[model samples]
Target chain A: MTPALAIRNVSHSYGARKALDDVSFSVPPGSFTMLLGLNGAGKSTLFSLVTRLYAARHGEIEIFGHNIMREPGAALRRLGVVFQARTLDLELSVMQNLLYHAALHGVGPIEARRLGQAALARAGLAERAKDKARALSGGQMRRVEIARALLHEPRLLLLDEPTVGLDIKARADLLALVRELVQEKRLGVLWATHLIDEIADDDQVVILHQGRVLATDRAQAIVVAQGAANIGEAFTRVTGVAQEKLSA
Target chain B: MSEIAAPAGFTFRQYLICLSGVVWREGLRFLHQRERFISALVRPLVWLFIFAAGFRQVLGVSIIPPYETYVLYEVYIAPGLMAMIQLFNGMQSSLSMVYDREMGNMRMLLVSPFPRWFLLGSKLLAGVAVSILQVYAFLLIAYFWEIEPPTKWGYLTVLPALALSGLMLGALGMLLSSLIKQLENFAGVMNFVIFPMFFASSALYPLWRVKESSPWLYYVCEVNPFTHAVELIRFAFYEKVAWTSLAIVFAYTSAFLVAAILAYDPARGMLMRRGG
Candidate 1:
């Protein structure tokens, strides 16, 4: 089967400053792919390119087999994204936010309502549907966003630092939710983060450092190949960052 | 991956659904913010009640084509105030856009599977719809104050003109919003674009009066799109049409819309290093 996403020889620059250089990676179906990067490591830049928020001017990005620039409608239909920023309109009810997103994806009112209610219930937010979005906690808001992302039944989900501000318990629950999605729904996930604990030994890893991909393989494979104890050390060895700083 | 990729598009039914959804959301936002509705009406009503009252003695009116005979100063400035509501509304949409960009709501809309032009056009139409409601509300209030149009049909005739003029100003606002990335910088836009566009147009005074004051300002007013918008509304209110003004408003609306579409394009427009 074709990889759910492909970035071929992608390089992006901001005027004289380069943000991403020769970066390429792919996430296979039914796998948790960790995009490991430090702050300003061009992770978000790659996400922007993949989502067509910014055109991949120097290379090509394809979802499944659809080119984003040539067939954005088709590519976007199969892809769902949760950006790093908070997006819910605080003034709108939780259901309104979900319905608004559903409408943008061309979902009809009756069907959107059905899917929205079900999605919110799955997120443990069924009771908050009529409440203002501001009533939800940070973790609840993140869950709402995830529920919104899945409303279209996308084949691939791209999340950028989703657990950044969440508490440890909430973070674990969030990760488990996504992991369950991968296992049960056979969804392709590109989870971008700087956290080392989020990656499992069997999970696919893409180590991006300073705009370059240092390695692309299983977490255990990279750790064993580098003779490191864990993903943090492996990342340090490949990217030349200190082990102490890697986990921090 | 589906093998068939010819740049997919929504069916007409899907397109209509999306359109209604967008308009409905806009209406919801408008309804939730009763202050926005009040402010939209208050701005025009203030001028009609106070500024026009004061100017009634300063400016004498001759029989213009749109005016059957001698008309009150408040009657003469009614269309301008209606267009003012739209102009402010267009800017209001821009303000919302700036805020929405920061809040990430714009990202949700921009990531839609539909075309960008269609999305922006729907937003423009929504803003126009809001402006029309506000205009009619102001007209009802003004009607009680003896600011009625020439004919009862004038009320209906003015609807299309208000829509067209709203589109022109709304497109202008959309173009500005695309260019304005930061909210702090928006204050400068209000001062530089809004005040000048409103005051330099024939909204407050006649072109002959402007020419008498300064010939260059008269020329500026003649070319101002807002002037044409006001003229369009003025003529339509009297059951007549200003063909030249209509064409000019249409052309400017198209130009502004095209520019807005380009400005919002990430690859072609605003490719600032921080964002790209």
Candidate 2:
């Protein structure tokens, strides 16, 4: 089977400043990949390219063997994105948000409603489906966004700093939930963040710094290779940042 | 991955469904925002009642319409005000686009499998739908104010003209939204684009009246795209179609829409300028 996502030698720039530099990675089905980078490390820029929010002029990105630029309709039908920023229309009900996303993916109303309800149920937000998105708490709203992204039944999910504003418990719960979905639904995940704690030993980690890929391997492997005791030390060593500085 | 099968490329039926969904959401959002509906009416009504009342005597009217005799200032400016509503509404929709871009809602639309133009078209159509409702409401109020159209058929005749003019202005707004870097600059857009377009057009004053005062200003008013839009609606309200105005409106819509599409191209750095 083809990898869920494949980025080959992609580079992007804003004017003279390069944001992503010949970056390359792939995520297999049912696996979780953490895109680790510091602020201004070009993780978001890579995500934007992968999602076709901006075109990558120098390289290519593919979703499930379909080139994004060549076969966007086929490639995008299987990809979902949860951006870092809040995307919900505050005035719209949770259900309305999900249903609208479903429609955009060519899902009919009846099927959209059915899948929306199921996604909400999965997110533990079925009870709040009728409430306006503004009425929900931030954590609840993030869950709704996840539900909406999954409404189209995308095989690959790309999340950019998903737990930015959530509390510790909420953040942990969200990570756990996403992990469970990766296993249960066999969904490929590209979770981008600067947080070191979110990286698990078994998970694959891609370290990007200043638009360049430092390393791509299992978290445990990186730790062992760097002669570090834990991923936190391994992350700092790979990205050339101090531990205290990283957490700060 | 095995849980959900990926569908094929977008089908025509799916396109229709997306269009309907977008339009429906716009309608629902409009209904929820009662202030938008009220303001949409109140703006034009104020112009029709108070502004026109003051200008009626100052602007002499000749026998030029389905009516054999001279008409009131209210009658001449009605279509102009209607087009003005569309122009403002088009810009308002652009404001929403800017807000949505900042808020991340635009990403949902952009990442869809459908073509970018289709998604933008759906949005334009939705804005037009709302503008149409607002225009009809204003017309109803005008009717109650004893400012009726030339014929019962005139009401229906104005629909296509309103839709075209709305789309023209809406496309222009979309282009501006794409080019504008920051949301705060939207107010600048109002001052530079919206006010100039509204005032310089023959919306409040007839082109001939401007000609009598300053031929240069008359030439500017005659060439103004909004002026043609207003003229299209004005003629339609009198149960006639100004073929030249109709063609000009269509041309302006096409040009603005094409420019908007180009400006919205992610490769051009507009969408990428703001945080996505």
Q: Give the top-scoring candidate (DockQ).
A: 2
**TM-score of the B chain in each candidate versus the native B chain:** 0.95, 0.95
Residue B6's lDDT in candidate 1: 31
Task: For residues B230-268, write the lDDT of model 2, one tens digit per residue.
Answer: 989988887888999999999989999999997777777
Runs in model 2 lying further than 4 Å from the true structure: B1-5, B65-67, B272-276
Tens digit of per-residue lDDT, candidate 1, span B64-159: 777778888998899899999999999999889878878877878888888888988988898889889999999999999988886699999999
Interface alpha-carbon RMSD, every candidate: 2.3, 2.1
What is candidate 1's CAPRI-style docking category based on DockQ? Answer: medium
TM-score of chain B of 2: 0.95
Model 1 chain A weakest lDDT span, ten residues long? A239-248
Q: What is each candidate's DockQ, to 2 decimals? A: 0.64, 0.68
Worst 10 residues of 1 chain B by lDDT: B1-10
Q: Rate the local accuracy (lDDT) of all candidates.
A: 0.89, 0.87
**Model 1 misplacement above 4 A:** A243-248, B1-8, B271-276
